[model samples]
Target: MEESEELQSILSYLPLLMRSSSLFWPSQAVETLRELGGGRVDSGYLLFQAISHLRNALSLSSEPLSPSTALGYALFFDEVMSGEESRKWFREVVPVLGNLLLRLPSLLETHYQNPHNSMRTATALRLLDSQLPGIIFLSQELIAALLGCSFFCLFPVKDRYVNHLPVINFDELFASLYEDYNQKQENKIWCIIHYFQRISSNMPKGIVSFERKVLHLKNDYTHISCPDANFWSTSTVPLCRVEVHNSGLIEDQSSDAVEVDFANKYLGGGALGRGCVQEEIRFMVSPELIAGMLFLPAMADNEAIEIVGVERFSSYTGYASSFRFSGDYVDEREVDDLGRRKTRIVAIDALCSPGMRQYRTNFLLREINKAFCGFLYQCKYQLYQKKLQDNGCSSALFDAATSTSMETSEGKFSDHKTTNSQNDYHSMDQGNNIGVATGNWGCGAFGGDPEVKTIIQWLAASQALRPFISYYTFGLEALQSLDEVAHWILSQRWTVGDLWNMLVEYSTSRSKGETNVGFLHWLLPSIYGHDEVIQTQLHCVSCSETDKRVVGMEAYLCGLLAHQHRYGLVDYSNYWMLCVALRPFISYYTFGLEALQSLDEVAHWILSQRWTVGDLWNMLVEYSTSRSKGETNVGFLHWLLPSIYGHGTGMDFSNLA
Candidate 1:
């Protein structure tokens, strides 16, 4: 055969040979095509023929061929095409290639549906790395598609080593690919790598360089640093080559150096000086000096720092200068008519031992009480204004009634209504019989308007309503008062339950012999009703007969309330609190299928409440752990043990069933 004729014949049959299913002699066909293309006998024509053959193969089946064969074909075409030709071909063919790449996973799912096929897929990906490195280049969608194929192929496989084939050596491939693109493409590279890093466990190298470049581009100097020992350490000293002027008009170098040093020192000092004086001063002294100043030996036997004053239930014991409960304190004068003399006040104080005092007094309760009264006064004022707008009642009759009422309540009302004109205006507005009233003056005044009323009513009906209501209206208000007494105990910072625990501890330890459990002990009965109290008592009768159940119940309620206050919703914390609170009942009820049913109810509640799935899973794990202990809730063990802990004996039919 003539060489040209033979070359033509080989080229003519290349497409058909590439697409053939018969594996026998396929490499021979590939070699023939490569040799013809290598000879430069109609080079472009040969390259076109190879691409056409590959395109035909890609078009032939939706199913993926053995990736090795597919990759071999791709490499053959890539080898034939010159860099310029590759660029031209890529620009023209990439959209099509991208579409094909996207469909590759689905095709693999159908055709390459075996363990050996995964290796083929990996090989194909390597070919993609060689030929169409720019195809997956920085395209997250394309990379994700590629990863999807690998993940699905490997997911069913048990061996971890084999499964990692697709991702192995990815960093080297990425670095090489990124170097091909211009700086304009850096962001795309970053986004792609960032996502890949998040999902894949193996950390990609050169990532810090990419990150630094990105930060540099963004001008975010906060994280900027020179190559440091920790990150990019080097053994050799870096050298700089500078071109010096031969015309030596010597520069005044020493003065410039001194000026620079002076500026740096002053700026550094200014920055340092801006920090807390006390902290800076403390750092300046040695422990020996501090001990000596405080009249204690540096290495004395009692070296522990002591905080005096209120030793509250906090992790730290500290001194407080002033303490008062959170509340609106009515003056002894105003409530005197109600026959209430001196208002009871609780003070919370935190004090440090040996020195310094910070007073946190709840004198604000009186201020707050006045504020609530002011709110009521405002409500009354609005009502009076509304009445004045209406012309229904006789002005004289209104005036007479107002005068009589004012005269009769003169002494009590004098302080509250300071001005005569203000009193007259109040009486005149009260005289007008307009039924028109602001919602604030109605039955749901402090609840805001009708919307707030509606919300409150809805909450009142909810199972979780009690905690919600108490926290907002009274419980949280009380917490605020308590916080005022001790500035650190802010509402929502620590729950009423935490305060109660602190109070209980304080009551037990008070040297003055005054033991008041405070409102903490009353919280449970106030919220859950007397029936819950009775049930709790019955459950805890054996543990302690004298109010121990009540105390436990209160603690539990407080914990739940605190959780709600902090998180802005009832969550797993509340469920855990409830579990702790009802533990005695849980123990009593754990003997039979009914207990499992209750456990199911709790699980269902967790699901129904739309709690976080992770939190629910954790709760189930905790429940399983508790049940595994052979404690009270053995029946709970049956359900929790099987579902999450994976320890229960069964046919293991969940997967199949």
Candidate 2:
């Protein structure tokens, strides 16, 4: 009687099951439902209908499933899941089971703990065994082996790995599948990396902190100076501020070569005699005579050689690329609280980029202290940095890593790997957010992973007191995704702790060359519902690329992107998707690379002005590649040479005659 009623119940809704596909459901499910609709299998549709009703149950009920319905769900689920559809639609299937399983305690009562006679107890093994591995990249064969062997053991593991179907090697499988999905997924993930809000634009305005009435003035975090009638100057003598230049005395050159006549020219030669009594004073004593004696009979903590400052004879305005002359003004106000307009300039010995080691974190921090020690007492810069890093302000920044300024390489591609050791990654002002204007921080000029470095910088800035990051993304679609990814992670409510662990896992998997289980996987979980990800074939950044063989007006601009996989620029897949999608074979390279080569010569020919290594990164991705999307060859070069990182330094783009 029960079986007859169940069969009648399944028949009522089996006709309503049409073709449906989702990330959680297999494409084969539509056909499977079609097969069941043909009246060939009545029992199979019965199992299918029971599972389908679970979705209806959840959509309708906020409460748990009834005791009887939950038990029936487990038995029917077991019957249908013995088929391939269970594995294919595993993501959709598992959630229903978990929800129904919630009612087990109510149904079994006390026997729920160890119900040997209960069907729910009998079905408990299936509940545990039926769960599909949540990870998407595992080959179908590995998955089958995993399912067969249970969670803890790998005995059923055949020596072969598999894709949606089957494969021989684990490493080789991901090597092909990974990059294909990464770039294809990025196509759908269009990040708004750069937003240059103009004075006249309708974009959002930032909170400007300028002159306003405030409570008290505090220098850094220490040394608060407040006005009170109680505090008064005790000393009658006027005081002079001493300027410390850690670089050593500016005018005190080494005493090596000097004739007796020149030496005694003005009471010790190079000394100036203004004839005034104050200007005629000469100094020929050790530092100890003027300041405190050295500590530990070695170096003094506050010991600094007094350095002089001269008035700047010129003036300039604007920061970075906006710098220009805005007229000069005379400075008559000389309060000189620290010194008489003096600057203790510590001049370290000049050193070129010595094999790139000079820019490493450990090395750079070593150099920062040359000036830090001089201002340690009065300046709270270092102290401020410590406060920023430790105060747990990372949650405040959601879009920190959203800025990136790089593109795919034009030559042979090699997978980049990194280990997440946040300790090794240090910034002196880790949390200061103090005007850190940077581009290509760990790539381009140095050998490093652009993605990893960009992530690290974002993580550092997230904890900063005032992070004013400027990512010059150069209008590249790929670069913009960094920020978009950051935005999505935040929108999904992933915390810093979540991202840090995800990165560590991703880095570990990256080093092992795992498929479908890294940064993008963590950032965008929605893409992995279907094992087979849909991807568009590669197109030139110059979508309207001209044919090189059939010579025409712009035939010279054609250059082939080197060693493209099926997805062109992405370093995956052996098979290109379609002919129209794949770019036509040209004899040259990527638009960025070719344009860079041409711009180099043009920049020198037009004017002798040199380009800085970071010059191309202007206002976060608005640099050299801004016009690279459509223009080809000489036209690209012409636009680029001027605008790069072209349009050029001051060349006008207007065709105004």
Which candidate's TM-score is highest? 2
TM-score of model 1 vs. true structure: 0.15
Superposition error at 553 for model 2 (Å)? 45
**Tens digits of per-residue lDDT for model 1 on 1-657?**
122321222222112221232212234334433443234323333433443343443233332223333233234235434576555443433323324333433433332222122121121111111101000011223233333222112111122122221221112222332234232122222222223333233211110000001011122223211122111111111111111222211111111000000011011111111111111112111001111111111111101111111001101111111111121211121122212211111111111121101001121121112111211222233333344356555463333324322223223223243132222222311221111101111112112222222121211111110111111222222232322222222212333223333333332333233322232222222233545544433111111112223332222211111111122322222233343223322222223434344454444443354443233334455566777886536454355445444554522323210
How many clashes in candidate 1?
A: 19
Give the TM-scores of the predictions, in the order they appear.
0.15, 0.21
Query: In lDDT terms, how accurate is model 1?
Result: 0.24
- True lDDT of residue 207, candidate 2: 12
**Model 1 lDDT, residue 515, Cα:** 24
lDDT top scorer: 2
Please, what is the whole-model Cα lDDT of each candidate in the order they appear? 0.24, 0.25
User: Alpha-carbon error at 33 in model 1, in Å?
Assistant: 99
